[model samples]
Every structure is written in structure tokens, then in C-alpha cells.
Target: MSARDVLEHLQRLGMSGYEAKAYVALVGAGRPVNGYEVAKRSGVPRSTVYETLGKLVARGAAYELRGSSDATEYLPLPPEALLDRMRREFDGSVAVLRSALPAVAAAPEGHLIHGLKDAEAMLDRAEDVIAGARRGLVMSVWPEEMRRLREAVVDAAERDVEVSVVSFGEDADPFGGGRPGAVYQHKYSAPEAVLEDLGYRLLVVVGDRREAVVGGFGEGAAWGIYTADPAVALMAAEYVRQDIALQILADRVGAGEIDRLFATDPGLLRLLGRARS
Candidate 1:
């Protein structure tokens, strides 16, 4: 990265701009640098250079040395060491907050629902649901989303979560080529036909029959809901279950017959937002 990018990243890691500049100057010098040299090389003000160096020393980002001439010099902590220290500190702080924040305010007990603003957030919520599944997981996903969430689903299956997936689109696979759990290829509706009817590709994920994420993805738009409501969760689960059942029935009765029935039946056509000729 560029020097400016490095400075910006350092500042993000809790260093002041002046401190980051001074530390970079010291590291670039390849030896201890006095305040005058730091200020000259870093473009930090001469008046503030010593204070910035002191702050860096306090933060373990640099070391202060007294030369034989009694002049103070600052040497940067090695970049690798500084990064390792920052990672440890950051992880420790997150661990503490994870335990402390829950005690500060207990979450309200109810059917909590959250709206996901876009596709990334929707997939992230889906991954969280999959990761949290202890008993069972039911999901109806398209090929694109399946690729993105395949690892998490496989991990859940490895944890004995009893995963079942109804995958849409031509290339959908729950675990690449190996099936770790029950994976059914959706055949009742063509993916294009479903998208034409609904205006988007749909995704449903239910975890342990307790939590769910139901969402839609389009070319440049996505929206979804994540809910802990048992009723919503059950509905999402049932959606996948019914899709799986239909796929199984198609396997027995033939997909062509099922397609013909849906194509001609007025009620089914109406359900698909279509009119039978």
C-alpha cells in the first residue's frame, strides 16, 4: 500500500495522525530519530513532534532512547510486532464487550424481526442462522447464494445440525458435489419463471425451527427479514419442507407431469401469478 494508506490504517488502529506520521518517519529512518528529524521527515509540527513521540512510546508503538548527548530519540516498534500487539488488544477488548454488553441491557423477549437492507447483509444473516443451528436447518436457496453460503452450511452439517436444502437454479449444490445432508434440486418451477413471477430470486433459511431469514435478490437490489419469531421460523421451515416434498414427488411421478399440471391448472397458475390459456 501507499505510505498515505499505511498512515490512514495506523490512525484507524488508534494512533493519532501525528503519532502515525512520527512512527512512520522513525521506521523509515531505519534508526532512532530525534524530534527535529521526525518533524522534518513526517511533516508533523516541530512543536507537537515530541508530544506525538511520547504518545507513541506510551502506546508501545515506539521506544524512547536517551543518547550520550542527552538528546531523546524515538525508534518505531517493528511493524510486525506492532500489528501482533494491536490484534491481541483488539481481540481482548471484543471478548470483554461480548460478555459485558449483554448484561447492560437484556434483549426484550418477543418475536424480534430485523430488516436487512441489501444482499450482503441478507447473506450474512443467513450465515449466522446456519452457524447457530444446533438441531436442524432448512433452506431454500438459489445457485448464487448457495455458493456463498455453502461453507457455513457444510460446517453446520458437520456439527450434526441435520441440514436440509432445496436448491433452485441449474447449478445448485448444497456441498459442491458431495452431499453432507439432504439436498433436493427444486424442479416444480423454473428459476426464470419464478423470478418473472416474483420479480426476484428468493431465499429462505430456518435454523433449529427457532430463527429464520427470508429474502429476495435482484440485479442490483436486495431486501430481507431476519426473525426469531417461532411462527415466522416455522413458516420458513415449512416452505423448504414443501419444496423438498414436491421435488420428491416429481422424482416419483415425473417432472414433466408436474409441470403439465401446474401449466394447465387455473388455481396453480393463479398462485404463480399467471393466467391459463
Candidate 2:
């Protein structure tokens, strides 16, 4: 591998800049090298090299030994050994992360949210809701929300959870490939009929217990509401059903070849046909 590639690989495996550089220098030197020479060759600071070397030694990727002047010298562990040690560290971290994450409760579970920060927080809660969902999902989304929403959907899909999305064409596949569900991609009847303006309309309705809605208008940047009430969830579910209906009907014709038979509406079905082409 190239020098840059090896250095990057080390850094990614949790090595500090000096530590990675020192390790690289020792790897090339072909034998133990004193701290000063190691720092000079690696371009690392003399003052910090000892500490960095100690960390590496503790990790078993480096060794300290007697040198020609009775000074301290360091050696890099073999490449495979370094890789194995780092992999074990990564596995343990992943296991800890998996254990810590699944235990977190969605704070407030359901609550109104306003402003950018609250909206962001609400998005996090949406992740927990989707992670725990079993039967189905309904979501209303726009482009700005894509980063978080896409992850939630992909995670759900990866976990085999059902996901369905309703969104304007910010080009987010709320049902992205990871999940085996549906994405409703037809345009709404009117510009007024979106997640906002009609008042806190953006929402995620999961199963029958939780529904989160956040919107004051995508551009107007207003507040939104979230609820655990079955009544509210039911309302959100119905709204999604209606939007999904449009997607279902439109996708069939616009997304498929039904366009030749039904050309009046160029909805999802027509789009699907065009996509196929």
C-alpha cells in the first residue's frame, strides 16, 4: 500500500497522528530506532513521541527496547498482528455500541417540536420509533430531512421492518432498497396540500401507538407536534393511506406501461414506465 494509504489506515484504526506516523517510520526502518530518530523520520514531535509510543506498546502494535546508546527504541508489530488487534478492538466497540443503543428509550416518546434543534431532536426520536416498529411505517418528508430519514428507513429495512414513505420529489426513496416495503412517489394534488402550511403536518405514524408530526412549512420554518395518542396516530395513518393511495394508483399507470392505455395522468405509473426505459 502507498504511504498515504497506510497512514490513513492507521489513523482510522484509532491511532493519533504522531502514533501513526511513528509506526509507519519504524515499519520502514527495518529495525528498532531510538525516539529522536523515530520522531525525525516520522516528522512527529520529540516531546510527544514517548507518550504515543507507550500507547502503541500497550496496544501490542509497538515495542520498546534497549538501543545502541542504551537509549529507548521502538518497533512496530507485524502488519497482520496490528490488524488483528485493531479488529478485536473494533468488534468489542461494536458489541458495546449495540448493547448500549438498544437500551435507550425515546425521550418524551411523543411531544411537540419547534425550531431547528427541536426538529433535529424529534428526528432522533423518529429513529427509535422506526427501529422498534413491527407492522408498518408512514412518513412525510422533504429534501432537507433526507439525511436522517434515509438512515432510519435503511436501518428499518436492514432489520426487515416495513417502511412506506410519502414525500414531494426531493428525490428521497423513503423506502430505499434496504427495506422491503413501498415508497409512494406521486405528486400531491395541490402545492397547499403538503406537510406544512396546513399546520404541523409532517409526520411518521408507526404501528398504531406512535405518530410524530413536525411542520410549519418547509421554508417558513415553523413548529410542529408529535403525539402518542392513538387518535392522532390514526389520523396520521389515514392521511398517509390517502397519499399512499395516490402513489399506488399513479405508480401503477405512470410508473408502468399502463401509460399507453391511460395517458391523461402522468403520475408514478407513468414515471415508472419512463424509469424502466
Candidate 3:
């Protein structure tokens, strides 16, 4: 990284800008440097350089030395050592907070609904749900999302969690040709047709009958709702179950007949949000 980047990062780690600059200047000097030299090299103001150096010394980020001439010089703690100390301190703080935070407030009682505002957030929550499944998971996902979530689903399956997927898109092998779980390819409509009909790509995931994520993915935009509401979870799971059952029915009968029904049946057309011809 650039020198400016290093200084910025140091500042983020609780150093003042002048302190970071002085520390970097000391490190770059390769020897103990006085306040004047630190200010000259680091562009820190001469007035504040000694104060910044004093702070760094107080923080154990630098050492102060008294030369034979009785002038004070500052030497930086090695970058590796400074980083290691910061890491240890940070981890310790986190560990304390992890145990202490629960005492601060009781968790809210009601099932909460969270909004995921982007595709990455949706995928992350989906992956978390899949990974946390203990009994079963049901999901309707497109090819791209399936690829992204395949590992988590497969891992859950490996843990003996029952996994069922209703996949969309043209790919013949949704799980990259691996049978991680019971996968049903949605043949009732093409992915493009479904997207056009819904005006967005739909994704639903339910885990262990306890939590559900329902979302829409679109070009440069994605949004979703995640809930631990049992009713919502059951609905999302049932949606996938119905899709899987329909796919099985299509396999037993034929895709052509299902298409004919969808095209002609008023109920089916209405479900698809299409007006009767």
C-alpha cells in the first residue's frame, strides 16, 4: 500500500493524523529522529510534532530516547509488533463484549422482519439460513444464485439436513451436476418468461421451518424480507413444495400438457397474472 494508505489505516486504528504521520516518518527514517526531523519528513506541523510523538510514546507505539546531547528522539515500534499488539487488544475487547453485551439488554420478544436491500445481503442471509438448518431447507432459486449458494446447501445436506431445491433457468444441472439434495428443475416456464411475468427474479428460502427469506433479484437492484415468523416460513416452504410437486406432475404427465393448461385455464392464467384471451 501507499504511504498515504498506511497513514490512513493507522488513523483508523486510533492514531491521530499527526501521530500516524510522525510514526511513519520515524519508521521511514530507519533511526531515532528528533521532533524537527519528524515534522520535516512527515509534513506534521512543528508545533504539534512533539505532542504527537509524546502520544505515540504513551501508547507504546513509539519509544522516546534521550541522547548524549540531552535531545529527545522518537523511534517507532516496528510495524509488525504494533499490528500484533493491536490485534491482541482488539480480540480481547471483542471477547469481553461478547460476554458482557447480553447483560445490557434482553432480546426483543417478537419475531422480527429484516429488509435486505441488495443482492449480496440477500445471498448472505440465504447462505446463513442454509448453513444454520438443522432439520430441513426448502428453496426456489435461479441458476446464478444456486451456484453461489451451492456449497452452503451441500454442506447442510452433508450434515444430514434434508435439502430441497426448485431451480429455474436453462441449466440442466443446477447443482453443477452434483446431487446435493432433491433438486427439481422448474419446467413450467422459462426463466425469462417468469422474470417478465413477475417483473423480477424471485428467490425464496426457508430453513428448519423456523425462518424464511423471500426476495426479488433484478438488474442492478435487489430487495428482500427475512423473517423468523413461523407463518411466513411455512408459506415460503409451501411455495417451494408446491413448485416441486408441480414439476413432478409435469414429469409424470408432460410439459406440453401443463403449458396447454396454463395457456387456457382461467385459474392458472389468473395465478400467472395474465388476462384471459
TM-scores of all predicted structures: 0.70, 0.53, 0.62
Clashes of 3: 0
Clash pairs, candidate 1, are: none
Lowest lDDT 10-residue stretch of candidate 3: 169-178
> Model 2: how far is 18 from its true place, Å?
6.4
lDDT of 1 by residue, 1-277 (tens): 9999999999899999999999899999999889999999999999888898889999999998999899998889999999999999999998999899999976787779999999999999999999989999999888989889988988998988898888886467767657744788776667777778788889999999999999999989999999999998998899889888988989899989987998889898787666845
- Candidate that scores best on TM-score: 1
The predictions' CA RMSDs to the true structure, in order, are 4.3, 9.3, 5.6
Which residue segments of model 1 deviate by more than 4 Å? 1-56, 65-87, 94-99, 107-109, 146-151, 170-174, 180-182, 260-277
Regions of candidate 3 where Cα sits further than 4 Å from its true position: 1-107, 170-174, 260-265, 275-277
Clashes of each: 0, 14, 0
lDDT of 3 by residue, 1-277 (tens): 9998998999899898998889889999999989999999999999988888889999999999999899998889999999999999889998999889988967879987999999999999999899879999998988778778888887887898888888886453345657744787787666677888889879999999899889998887999999999888998899889888988989888999888988889888899777655
* Better candidate by TM-score, 1 or 3: 1
Give the per-residue lDDT digits (tens) of candidate 2, residues 1-277: 8998988988988988888998888899999888888888998888997887888898788898986778888888988888987898899999999889878956665554333336666666667667667767777666556566677777766776667777656465655433334766547433345444344435554553455554443453535555566676777777777778866766656644544444555575465454334
Point out the worst 10-residue segment of candidate 2 by lDDT: 188-197
Which of 2 and 3 is the better model by lDDT? 3
| 177: Cα error in model 1, Å | 1.6
The predicted structure with the larger TM-score, 1 or 2, is 1
